[model samples]
Target chain A: MRVLGIDPGLTRCGLGVVDGRPGRAGMVAVGVIRTPSDRDTGERLLYLEDNLTTWVRRFEPDVVAIERVFADVNVASVMTTAHATAIALLVAAKAGVPVAFHTPTEVKAAVTGDGRAGKAQVTQMVTSILKLTEQPRPADAADALALAICHTWRGGTEIRYAAAAARAGGPR
Target chain B: MRVLGIDPGLTRCGLGVVDGRPGRAGMVAVGVIRTPSDRDTGERLLYLEDNLTTWVRRFEPDVVAIERVFADVNVASVMTTAHATAIALLVAAKAGVPVAFHTPTEVKAAVTGDGRAGKAQVTQMVTSILKLTEQPRPADAADALALAICHTWRGGTEIRYAAAAARAGGPR
Candidate 1:
């Protein structure tokens, strides 16, 4: 299965695509979207949407995974972040890709065995899991990769639940 | 000149288009982007971006006008609004269109002759100004149109200031 992970933001968004099978997982593509300073909010969103749409079209991931907002802090920032996140989800939905959300804590826990893992630690774990020569820069990209990893593990639990339900003749 | 105005929000956004020429200003389009409640924040933003981009491409506006956030309440809400605004600006810039911003009071003053006009009064003025058969269905769309009209009137101020600057520099 192919999965796309995203770390959404106004100025920079980190995106990563990965492929996984029964016993193997590999990174496909990863990059950051940087918006210009002179541009206004609307322009930045458009830039992100256009770039992200093109990236999704090119990568063709079967599923999309993104980090969920943690708190209700700073209403404006949250809304802006939410807007960025919304665009990511909308793209996947439009492209017929199912979306899964993972909290930062869950992602950190899955990747580093710690719920409160620091950004650097999460980056290191992502590099280690992906077996990359160097860590993904800007922190956002690495977090995105970690989010993908968390989705893989979480998805495994969902599969088990489905199998259990199927054996019990319940909804799958 | 064609101008697009945007009223950014978390779930729904108001979009308004107007043609501006010193004396004549007419509404070209006005509508709201509605998002599903079940969708997450990231998903909503993506949807807005896609729809807005389509609007920009289809309408080919020469300039874009958007409202500025000034209220002190709900800081996070303001931030998200700002992000949405940024997205609009980014899209216009990409299309090689300039952007102008106006505050709530300014737009109200331009449309209703009062800076502190209530939402109902603003809506009435917007409907009258655009010669619409009925009030703009959504309050946000009406406010967005007000911003567009404000931009048309305010745009000349910049030209006048530029002329003054040029004259000041002439053989002085």
Candidate 2:
């Protein structure tokens, strides 16, 4: 299965694509979409939508995984982050790709075996897991990759569990 | 000038359109766009976009005015409101209509001359100002009309001030 991960932000939205499922995966692409702060919020949102639509069409992933934004974060940035997230969700839905949201802690736990793992540790593990020659620059990019990896692994388990449940004739 | 005002919400998005300027205005349209709560967020957002796009096209407003969402308000609903607000902003930008945000206080003050005026008072004032025979149904619709009226009156002052500044050979 192919998955596209997004770390949503108005200024620097990170995008990462990965292929495979369960224990093994390969990175297909990683990058960020930047919008100028000087532009009006509407224009910036439009730019984000354009870029995200492009990414969705170009990659044609089976699923889109996004890092969920919490309301408890810095008040000033949370609203903008939420706006960016809405765009990501809209794009994925418009493209007919299912979406999954992973919190920062959930992503860290899935990749580093610790819910409170530091950024460096998460990056290290992502690099090792994907067998990349170098760490993904910009913490947002790494975070996006981690989200994809987390979804891939977790989603595999979910599918298997459902299959097993079907074999048993019903859900518990 | 015509103005389209939106009171953004996921479940009940209020829409109001007004014509004229400042002290004299007429309500051209007032309604709400309802989405099923059982639907997923992405699908709801897409439904909102579609409805909002139709509003912009049919009304051909000079500007789009939206109620600004604050982070401190009911955390559970704030994120969804922000998402709806983003879709409004995006639609305005795509349609090439200037967008303006008016705080709740600003709208209240513009309509009733009291920033902290209660909802009932604002609704009464809107009904009177638009010379309507009865109150606009649903508090959301009333609030939206208030926003458009606020922008019309305030935006008029802003435009006149800018013109005055130009007449004086530059901004002070």
Candidate 3:
């Protein structure tokens, strides 16, 4: 399965696409969409929407995985992050692609085997797992790749279990 | 001037439209767009987008006024509210309508001359100002109308000031 992972932010939104399932994955693309601080919020959001729509149309990923925003994180940025996330979710839904959210800890644990892993460690693991020649430039880019990897490994199991439940006439 | 006020929320998004300038205003439309809690977040947001797009098209307001979201309010709901707010902003921008944000205190003060006025007082003032025979039902609906009224009264001054600045070759 191919997954598009997003680390949503108004100033800089990181996007990474990976093709894989379970234990193996390969990076398809990694980049960031940046909006100028000088622009009004509405314009910036419009820019994000346009770029995200382009991403979805270009890659045609099977699923979109986004990093979940929590209210407790940096009160000032949380609202903006949530706003950007909403745009991403809307784009994915409009494209009819399934979307999943992975918490920071879940993503770290999935890639590094430790929920408390440091940034460098997570980046290092992502590079090794994807067999990349170099580390993803910005921390946001690495985080997004980690999210895709996590969803591929973890979400794969969940999808299988859901399918099994459906076969047995159980709750989905 | 015609103004569309949106009190953004995932479950019950309140929308109000008013036509008039500073002191005098008439209610053109007032209602809420609701989404079921059972629907997934993406689907619900899509529903909001559809309804809000319809509102913008049908009303053709000169300005779209939305309630500003703060991170401090009801931690569980703030993120969702911010998400909804983003969709409103996106819709306004896409339609080329100018967007403005008003804090709760600002709306209250504009309507009731008290920034900390209670909801009932604000609702009563809205009902009186529009010369409506009946108070707008649902606190959300009343709050939305109050926002529209506030924008009609307050935003007018800002718009005039901006125009004056432009005429004077001053910064806008």
Q: For all the predictions, what are the DockQ values? A: 0.32, 0.88, 0.81
Candidate 1 stretches with Cα past 4 Å from truth are A21-25, A36-51, A70-83, B9-12, B21-24, B33-60, B69-95, B128-134, B163-172
lDDT of 2 by residue, B1-172 (tens): 8999999999899999999776889999999999878988998899899999999999999999999878887887999999999999999999999999999999999999999999999999999999999999799999999999999999988988988999999983
lDDT of 2 by residue, A22-100 (tens): 9998999999999989999999999999999999999999999999888997987999998999999889879889999
Interface RMSD of each: 4.8, 0.6, 0.8
Candidate 3 DockQ vs. native: 0.81
Ranking by DockQ: 2, 3, 1
What is the iRMSD in Å for candidate 1?
4.8
Task: Show where candidate 2 strays beyond 4 Å.
Answer: none
Top candidate, metric TM-score = 2
* Interface Cα RMSD of candidate 3: 0.8
lDDT of 3 by residue, B1-172 (tens): 9999999999899999999888999999999999878987888999999999999999999999999878877986998999999999999989999988899999999999999999999999999999999999788999999999999999889889999999999999
Candidate 1 lDDT over residue span B1-172, tens digit each: 6788888775668899988754458999998887565865546655666788899998898778888775375655665665466556656766778888788889998888999999999999888878989999789888888888788777755666777888899531
